[model samples]
Target chain A: TQLLEQSPQFLSIQEGENLTVYCNSSSVFSSLQWYRQEPGEGPVLLVTVVTGGEVKKLKRLTFQFGDARKDSSLHITAAQTGDTGLYLCAGALLENAGNMLTFGGGTRLMVKP
Target chain B: DVKVTQSSRYLVKRTGEKVFLECVQDMDHENMFWYRQDPGLGLRLIYFSYDVKMKEKGDIPEGYSVSREKKERFSLILESASTNQTSMYLCASSFGGLHSPLHFGNGTRLTVT
Candidate 1:
């Protein structure tokens, strides 16, 4: 099975600090997505990168997909207290049906004020 | 606005009790998924349906079963709840496409004793 592994299972940083999380996989994927989940809520999609070397920006958050489609990264700049949550990366396998996604272990971040 | 609604936010049930987790999507999405989130295991897909009456098993479907009698509603059933089944259950829906982003509902936290 294709697995996505996320590094630094936990992170705590002061507000306004910058942080980056990594998601790596040995298998190449057709698409990759990043999600942020708040406490007591389900994860919400932050960005989706479909092409290799693709980069998308959402305000202070930046996401990049590896050129080989085997990895991705999420970087947050000037983090705020509201950014405390769990970050997850998911990949859509090239051989699977359109609806299946394999998710990473996740990175829990705490942005302290 | 896309909304995915989970029937309950929290639940506690004794062992051997039957449990049902309900999910509904108003966006008329063709893909519905059930996942369980644990501390070290971010999101493990239990089951997914691409259409009404169509179901597919995910990575961890041993103790779970799903039903999708209607297009917008999906149900996860635990025939006999066990302590090992305790986890945060999440429901997500997305349009039927290769790179469609998922829309999630506030998860249901279930505790089995």
Candidate 2:
């Protein structure tokens, strides 16, 4: 079974603080996706990294996929109060598991002013 | 833009009562999934339908059943509500393919008391 584990289940930081959330797994994946969800809203896809050792940037957010495709990380720089939300990482396996994602426990971020 | 809509934003039911959760998608997606989101469990797929009248059991399909009568709508049924089932339920849709992205609904918070 493939399992994706996220570290620091909860994070609280002041405005302008930098933080990083990690997602680790022992099994290799074909692709990884990052999502941000706010209160009472569904998760919005931030980015999808398919290749190992891939890094994708979305403004103040940076996402990295492990070289072995077994892990991933999300980094936020100069985070604002608006950045507070639940961050989730999902992994997609190759084969019949196509389009199916296995999600992580998620990191709940709280940025206070 | 793809839009997934859940019939209810919140639902409260008594234990032993049957519950039905409905979802609809504006996009003609071939794959529709029902997932239960718990704080530590993340998003566990209960069931998924790839085509009309075709459904597959996911990793955690126990105590849950689903029906897909049409391509645009999917319904999840809980034979008997339980306190343990109180959580955010999410509906997502995506093209039935190898690497297509998924679109999600805002989610319905179901409380079983």
Model 2 CA deviation exceeding 4 Å by range: none
Q: Which 10 consecutive residues of model 1 chain A have the lowest summed lDDT?
A: A1-10
lDDT, candidate 1, A1-113, per-residue tens: 32999988999999999999999999999999999999988899999999999999999999999999999999999999999999999999978767688999999999999
* iRMSD of all candidate structures: 0.7, 1.1
Q: Which portions of model 1 miss their true places by more than 4 Å?
A: none
What lDDT is reached at residue A49 by model 2? 94
lDDT of 1 at A41: 85
DockQ of each: 0.88, 0.78
The CA lDDT at A38 in model 2 is 95
Q: B5-97 in candidate 2: lDDT tens per residue?
A: 999999999999999999999889999999999887778899999999999999989899999999999999999999999999999999877
Single out the weakest 10-residue window by summed lDDT for candidate 1 chain B. B95-104
